[model samples]
Target: MIEGPMGAKPEELDELCELVGKVFNWQMRENFPTLFCNDNTDNLRIIKEDGKIVSHFGFVIRDMIINGCRISVGNVGAVCTDENYRKKGYAWKILDQAIEKYRADGVDMFLVSGSRSLYIQHGCTHVGKVKNYAIYRGMPIPSAKVKAIKYTVDDLPVWSALYRNEPIRFHRPYNDFLVLTTSGLVYRPDSRLFSISDGNKIVAYVVGSCDNNKKSFGLHEYAGSRKAIIASIPQWFEELNVDRCVVPVNLYDIEFNQIFHSLGIEPDYGTTGGTIVIINFPQMCERLLPLFEEKIGSHIANVLTFSERDGNYVIGLDGDEAIISDPHDLARIIFGDPPILEAPTKIPAEGKLLDVIKAIFPIPRPEYGLSYI
Candidate 1:
């Protein structure tokens, strides 16, 4: 009989293999835990029952560069439960465990992929708008003075600089860069990394993965001069020559959004690529206060403070404070989602203040799926 994602042991690995293999048949069941482990098992977690594996969940701890600071993030993945165990509350329990693990481990944020509803119920909110689109046979290409080169270890610092230009991004150290560049995510093998260099300096770079099956093609990450990235897209698309290519870009990417808009390629705007749950609201607020103030002005931003009382988070403005009924809703406002105002409480952006807040936090640059496409 299948159990929940509660208890686990090394001997249960084989049974776990059968459970996930039968559910997600992408593998031949021969590679099991290694592929699931992604080469590291120190942080893997699983739940088993009656000497067999039933439900599973795993996470990887990584640092995201937010406003030039390293904010620890726990990326949750490989979530699965035995088909027979679907309604048994195993997944939620595992999710609870994960939340605590991340919080205790000092992770400031938690990121999970796939269904937003499932996570939203647990105080997480979908963040960032992404464009999923197709690159047709005759997509527009910009004139690029730089040439694309296969990315190498020596070019890591250059890539890091490019990545850092954006305020929010996952911090990929040289080792992580090597791993993803060489192997990508375990599931997607066709990933490619390249750089565009002008004369002697690398001006831009892009990382993308289009499955061998051609069913899924997408540009995952890009950095460097906006012009350089724009110029290189056409050539890259032409090189791949897939019937259709999908690309996801941050909603705040005015440069790219304008380019695509002018080219008649409409972006399907959305924030559903990934879900985020804030583990430490006070800390997040403190960290983001400067940015918030910078955007919304000192009047509103100065009053922007966060605190927890009686186990509920409340946003403060002066001496007044309003409890954020739902953490997800609070995330929505801070990240610049629509409908910024709420009934007056103690929150910084409440009632009429929302009008002021919206102007400042408009077009937030938050991103998800940066770890992969």
Candidate 2:
């Protein structure tokens, strides 16, 4: 057995499909033969055993806008290991390698969908408390008519803008968005992607699959204006025969909760959202400082600084003026989860320092954009 990063070569692509299919039960190769044909492959790390792919872990670096500033964020996905190779430390080894590589690559932060314990061991923390909204088929069937149309490569910029409607979201390139819209067939052949249009303008779009067993359509990602999203409801019911639609508060923005509340679709507060790992604390500070200065006023932002000790992350000024927070709390604080910041902490919860921190980092639950889970 040998370990190394695998290229998206013809033979390697076949092995990837086989390994992924065996472990995840998907026909990756045939469903999406051109999987990596256009995707950037600088970070497609893998570990092999006996001339076949056994384990894999990879990240795609994306340009993200936090507080109107462009920052590079690393999104980790496609993490899987061959079933026969499980419990052999292959995952840990590959994950460790991915972290080290990301650090050197200047990634300010890392985002992932699942696997909390493994990421926590690598200095990551699970964070965020977001509300989920579900619209049932019997709910009066909204009057809005959202026309669904197929999107072409030329429509990427429009889609990218719609995708980044949130305060915190990854900046997707044309190629990456293209891959996301089609990659599903690699996992599910019958998946669909379309732009929900209002007359000539594209209002919202949904990428999802249907579960025949339950007669439910699971939305992988949905983005656009609230009115647009709500208007598009008829399309889901008519085209997919989906009786229910589940979405996050961030996806719909602040208008989602209030509008749905009136319609009896209240939020479910039990969800944690996603896991975020800060790759570089000080670098993160440097990038966010300008935004802080603008929002919190120079009096506070001028003196504030970000640093880390041991494995703990924090942001503050000199002496005992620091705000001690873990990656989890920091992420929540950054995303404006009031409870986490206002919770018991060494930092002053309601003072000038806290005010400054909140002013700049006050964002809703971060959105990963088009290729969301």
Q: Pick the candidate with the highest TM-score.
A: 2
- The TM-scores of all predictions, comma-separated, are 0.77, 0.80
Query: Stretches of candidate 2 above 4 Å error?
Result: 1-11, 29-39, 49-52, 138-146, 150-157, 164-166, 183-190, 211-215, 262-264, 270-273, 323-326, 336-351, 358-362
For each candidate, the alpha-carbon lDDT, in order, equals 0.64, 0.64
lDDT for 148 (candidate 2): 75
Q: Write the per-residue lDDT of candidate 1 for residues 1-373, one digit (tens) a residue.
A: 5444443444555565567677777552232223344344445566666655677765667777656656677777667878876877777888887777667777877777665555778877665456765666566666768777778878888987887787668776666655555444424456667798886899988777776776445777778776776666566665766656666776666777787777688867655456677788777666666667667777787766678778677766556566776776666655655322343223344664555445544335445433642
RMSD of 1: 4.8
In candidate 1, what residue range of length 10 has the lowest lDDT sum?
A: 338-347
Error of 2 at 105 (Å): 1.0
